[model samples]
Target: AALAQGRQPLLLERTAGLGGRARSLFARDVDSMIDNGQHVLAASYHETRRLLRRLGQENAIHFQQPLSIHFRFNQRRNFPFRAWRLPAPLHFLLPLLFGAPLSRSDRRYLFRWGRRFRQTVPEQLKPLTVRQWLDEAGQSPLLEQLLWEPLTLATLNTPLRQASAFLLYQVLQKAFLSSAATSGLGLATRLLGEIFARPAEQFIRQQG
Candidate 1:
């Protein structure tokens, strides 16, 4: 953003690379590139997308359409959850209601949970953990195990018992209820260095 505003911003990195935690390694033996960790982005990451666009590397990230998630419980059982091309909330809500691998009772519980989330104010959530919030909101055990637990762990990198309710609530609002496009999943098609770090370095040098 500073670069876009005609300000020469100096970026200082102690590491040899620019990507920090999100970087890749090139193996000379196999001539293959490997990421340090898998980094997935949601369309709700507006600032990230904007920065990529500023670096002219938007196409380096490949985005999935319609926000589909495939969950494999077993070799024989796979559940696919796909969002509709509808408006905000409905796009995600309809899928949870009808298409997700949830039982009728689970769906009802989820609906009630959604209602409670909608009514909740951010300030009221600071003192609670995600597990406590879910229990208070009457989240079904099945739904918590199958969906919320995994999602919470993936998003917060913390167990529901330890994760903050307010943090999870903000993520839910952005990914599920913001807009149809906000839930789209983005994967970097190129190496992390090529996609972001190298381009950013070049941009900075050019500016300097």
Candidate 2:
């Protein structure tokens, strides 16, 4: 839609036939079959969903409904949070009531943080890492290690110890809302090359 609506720039950066990231090349006698990883897309990707639907390929893509979150440092230990897409305004509160990974106290602070942000000017709010927020809120290191640390690292792709506490708090706050909105989403599993590259090239050649 962005391309159709002139909201995105159109340009081909490379000149050549595009290729898929073939994962395995199995030579079976006279024929060779390649297997690739199953690609997954986030249900919340409105643009990709819209484009696929427009191309009549929505069926090829799958939606994992009642989105659930899974966390693991290892396979033996994992925490799961399940959620349902709420109708509307009520959706915002469900994460608090259910499908939340945070401890009851941490969850309360997450809400309080948002309410505080709403009431204060952005410039005045103290900036710190998620760890800082946890500490300031009186969350123990043990809780921080199991909870905020993983969440911060998972969301920011940065070590919790290194991340800015203030920024992390805001990021955590944002993720919390988005998760609530979508019944708690984690990712779109599709590889960049498979989901976007070929189709994009095809679209470009057709339109160019």
Best by lDDT: 1
* Model 1 agreement with the true structure over 79-167: per-residue lDDT tens digits: 78888889877787788888767888888876776677677799899999999988887787767876788778766767899999999
| Runs in model 2 lying further than 4 Å from the true structure | 1-43, 52-62, 73-77, 84-181, 186-190
Candidate topping TM-score: 1
> Which residue window of length 10 is worst by lDDT in model 1?
109-118
lDDT minimum window of 10 residues, candidate 2: 15-24
TM-score of 1: 0.82
Estimate every model's Cα lDDT from 0 to 1: 0.80, 0.53
User: How do the residues 26-53 of candidate 2 rate in per-residue lDDT, one tens digit apiece?
Assistant: 4477475333433334455567668776
Q: After superposition, how far is residue 121 of candidate 1 from its true place, in Å?
A: 0.7
